[model samples]
Target: MRRIPILVTLLLVAACSQESERTYTVDELIADEALLSRTISDCRNNPGELRNTVNCHNAEAADGKLRLQNMRKALGG
Candidate 1:
């Protein structure tokens, strides 16, 4: 089999692709907040942990915001 042209494939993908935005519901946002709070609480309760809960929480919040923004743009709202 022949290798696909990277640039051509990428162009085709971009041209035919639709931007899909995930819509977050109020409940989902609330759940994210709760999860973030729990992450903080976890770190607070234990000063030492392997996983970075705070970072994870922050990333989740950031991703949630991005998703919301994308969905808003998609809906033209």
Candidate 2:
């Protein structure tokens, strides 16, 4: 009786919680510099929590690729 209402309330609360954030791929992050910067900033700001996340990994990869590209361009290669 009372348990039914409690269960319903719990279900509603769980459903209203924040949805999981979608992760970006390395290529996607590379194509969006602003997003890449923001993601890197976020991962650095909360490293213990986000360092191992997919978004953080992709952001780091994208940053590496961009830096390598810049270096190549600078050397006229």
Candidate 3:
């Protein structure tokens, strides 16, 4: 009885803490752009292999693009 309640509470907390395709504010998107750029640039010289694919601007851009699109829609632009 008590254990079940505790388990349910834990599950609720975990779910709330998880991110679900949350959109970022414009400021956050801009900051992410800078960071992502730097990551790719560093990869160019270092050629970490993984860095090129990971930071060469695909995943982050896609995510940011979606968020920006959502923001634009929400703003009725």
Against the hidden true structure, what lDDT does model 2 obtain?
0.97
Model 3 stretches astray by more than 4 angstroms: 1-49, 54-56
User: Candidate 3's residue-wise lDDT over 46-71, tens digit each?
Assistant: 66554545344454564567678889
lDDT of 1 by residue, 1-77 (tens): 24568778888999999985344444454557665555445555765661454454454565567679889999999
lDDT of 2 by residue, 1-77 (tens): 99999999999999999999998999999999999999999999999999999999989999999999999999999
Whole-model lDDT for model 3 versus the true structure? 0.61
Candidate 1: stretches off by over 4 Å: 1-52
How high is the CA lDDT of each candidate model? Answer: 0.60, 0.97, 0.61
How much is the lDDT of residue 58 in candidate 3? 57
Q: Pick the candidate with the highest lDDT.
A: 2
Q: Show model 2 residue runs off by greater than 4 Å.
A: 1-11
RMSD (Å) per prediction: 14.4, 2.1, 11.2
Model 3 compared with the native: what TM-score? 0.31
